[model samples]
Target: MMAGMKFLSGKRSIFKVMGLICKKCALAIMVLALIAPFIATTQIILGDSKSDLEDAKKQQEDVQSKLEETKKYIEDLQGQVSDIQSYISSLDSQMETISSSLYELDLQVQDLEATIKTTEEELAKAEEDAKVQYEQMKLRIKFMYEHNDETYLGMLLNAEDMADLLSKAEYINQLSKYDREMLEKYKATIDYIAQTKADLEADKEELVNMQTNLQDQMSALSLLQSTKMTQLTNLNNTVAAEESYYSRLEAENEALEATTRQLEARIKAEEAAKSSVTSYDGGKFKWPTTSTRITSDYGDTDGRSAPHKGIDIGAVKVGVAGDPIYAAYDGKVVISTYSASAGNYIMIYHGDGLYTRYLHCSSLLVSVGDYVTKGQKIGLMGTTGNSTGVHLHFDVRLNGSYVSPWNYLSK
Candidate 1:
């Protein structure tokens, strides 16, 4: 309360008002006058304090608003990263297909070259045989032309008997028949070789055309692949650059809005989970992973800003990735999606407010609304999102809060 020495205008008015009352009032006035300066100072201090408090509250609100905005921005960036990765995968598939086609084309070209070599060899052999036949026919014709009528007349006059004369004439007729047959055979051979050469040239032309086509296609595919790779690289660079900024903002804003939202979502899921199942008759949950190695226990916050909500199972195998992640218990999947923090995570709702989570998965095998059995493979363990290494982060939420996996898992 603010106190003053005067009611109307001056300290005399305070004394006059008290005089009209009683001696008790006068005593009160005396006390009020003694403490008047202190009360006035206190009024100013109270006003300043209220203003300061309101200012502090406004600053807090502003900080909280900034935190939410920053979180939302980071989430958007994560989504963009996911989209770009999917595009990169698609481009990879296309490039593989192109490479396979190119490989096939290479094989065909090799076969064509082999066939052309064989054709040329066969063509050369036929031409050589035709030339030999031509030379033999020329010699025979020249010998017949030199002898001519003299040889035939000599054969007739020198004959001792009519039987010998007839035999000589028959021999001359047989020589004429041989000459005619050789000429016809040479003509046929020339025609067949000419046709074969023409066909071989056509095949060679076709092979050349095919190779030209393949080269053009390869050039186009190469250009497209180059463009796609550039896009992928740019996207990767953007993610790498923004991640640092995101971390800076995340460190400054201590609202933990993202964490709160996750908890809220789990809380909302509980109602739906309970409605779906009245109770869980299943005994102990199966181990969520093959590895029995526990890396991080629940509620442990060392090396991180926030407490760990689940158990992290390290890879105890030869490889880091592709380890099978199984369902802890039989339940219907309530949430199956990717997140900036959780990466590929799954939430399975068992009856009576019991839910399970698998985080940092390389791949998810089940979708929302799908029911899975205990020990069923749900995903492959991986180091995704905000993970440190290859591991399965298994979580159990009973009644909207994270619980210990040891309590649910069997020995």
Candidate 2:
């Protein structure tokens, strides 16, 4: 009975040691999974962490692009405002020139009026003199016709000498011709003065019309210039506001990065507190379940040729649909979704900005925000979103970029 008891005690001791070894092994494997993404060149397992990091990176990139585009838009708006301001300045110059021209036109009109008045006065005097001379000549010609025999003609005829008769006849003819020519000359001068007055009136009317048209054009230009100035001011204000907003966003992003670093340090300290285990030593790692070989390697070369971010582990024969999918390590469940390309997907945010992704699951066993333990069931592997058959799409992410998971796997 004592020997039997001794054998039983030995068996019990061995079992305890084996249990200890298994626990340690699992812990070490988890540690490697957490650290390998950063420290080593490794392929990633399709998991939640990888998806979270990738999504964050994509979001950051999109925001950066938007920021740049906004800057360019602001610059364009500024340029447009500048152009408007320049146009306003040009309008101001044009207005000044127009005002000056209008002033000159006013002076020209005044001078023309003065000249017209002077010309009219001179013409009126000339017309008065012509009329007086014409009346006097008519009176003289009529009187001569009525009294010619009793006047100079009669006297000249009365002279008996031949020389006197000839001189008297020539003198009468000269007087008669002088009276007729004076009447014609006075009429012609009066007609010329009337025509000059008409021309001055026409010139005054034309000058007034030209000045009115110019004033109308200047008024329109002034309105346009004022409108452009207002638009420019508004645009400048908009650009300033946008620039300030972008500045704030940049500051916020920096703060977020700092916070992320601190969290990673805390996670690292917590991980160190766990006791050491045998599984930490390099060896063939037991598959989380009896599963088929991987059908798609990490960073697969075919199709799209962009670096494959994860591996595809096929479920050939071991499990039925809706079977439990276990967590490879302890981590927080950060995201879960039925994504088009990933099917039912989950992203786990681990420490140090490391992340993992799991996809193509039939159903999720754990909700987002759940704290999972190592080997905890998180989902059921099955063909789901963007999947061809029953399999698991797994990934690893570091600082929001996809990395190889193979480097972290213990097997």
Candidate 3:
């Protein structure tokens, strides 16, 4: 009976040991199940953290690249501006030279005019003197003809002596010689006066031609100066726009870097806490304007010298101003201000690195940091800045690079 009790006690002890072992195994299994999930969650969080870090790093690189590119472009614009200024200065110098030449030419023309007037007076006097001398010569010739050779012969025959006849012949010969000499002298004077008048006229014609040429040159210079001035104005406007854009880009880069740092820190915290992450679904966006007709299509180079970066929506009455502009999606207003190139513009930041820009507005209805919903009125469309007509210039950006707005807008 004692041996039987010992056997039963030993069996009970074995059963207790098995039960303890089973309980330990179950506890280990439960712990393992919990630990496995924790490990998986940790892995997922780490993966998200890594991804966010990579995205931040990539964004930083992109910002740096854009900054470098903008700096280079600004330098290039500066050089162009300097060159244009120098060219304008050169043009000014040339105009000064032309002015000097024109002044001298005017003086020469005045002198020539004075000379011609004096010559004309001299010619008129010479003609009057010639006419009077001719009339006197003709009267003398008529007297000599009426007297004739018979009177000279009679005088010679009736002479008291040979000396008297010789004297009479000498008197007639002297009178005829005097009359011929006077007529020849008058004819020579008239010819000389005519030659002088012709020479003066020729000189005057040359001076007039020179004056006309100088005037033409002045006109050409004036036209060229006008063209250069216009070019300079355009260049100045472009520089102003580029400078504004550069400043905005710098601010954006700084903001992006700050956001990236914050994201990195947040990702680290999330990894430690194994927090949930939010994602964007990339939903379709609403049309930004009431008018559906596109005045300028995306990538169309019709009116633009380069590829158009965005689409332009015309007003309801076709080139009329003051149409309402709407937000394409729910977003926060990131920028709202006026620009020389974009006029009264607004930029919105939707989550997940998406952005939209509205340009050439006559008035703004929103401010920066204001939250806006899809189809909300944000501005009024009109021809401002670099626009030719009343329209809305709409743009979409993925990160900082421009993309087609059509990709996000509803058809």
Which candidate leads in lDDT? 3
The positional error of residue 134 in candidate 2, measured at the CA in angstroms, is 1.7
Estimate the TM-score for candidate 3. 0.52
> Which whole-number lDDT from 0 to 100 does residue 84 have in model 2?
66
lDDT of 3 by residue, 1-411 (tens): 332353355345435534543554465356445434432332111113346567656655655665676566657656755765775676577668767877887788788778878878877887787788778878877866898877778878988898988998898789778878877887787788778778877887887787676666567556655655665676567557657756755665675566556456544443332222132368898898888889888899985688888899889898788889999888777667665568788877776767788999999999766778889999999888878899999988675567888899994
Per-model TM-score versus the true fold: 0.41, 0.50, 0.52
lDDT of 3: 0.70
Which portions of model 2 show Cα errors greater than 4 Å?
Answer: 1-59, 158-168, 266-411
Model 1 clash tally, residue pairs: 0
- lDDT, residue 111, candidate 3: 85
Model 1, residue 24: C-alpha shift (Å): 78
Estimate, for each residue in 1-411, the C-alpha lDDT of model 2 and write its tens digit: 332353355345435534543554465356436533432322222233334345444444544554675577667666766666776776687678778888988988898899889888878887787788878878877988899678876768697898888888887788778777776776777677678778877887888887886787677666666666666666677667667756754654554344333334323432432222112222222233336478788878777457667787777574456655766666676656565567787666555655567888898877656776666778888888776688887777766577877765553
lDDT of each: 0.66, 0.63, 0.70
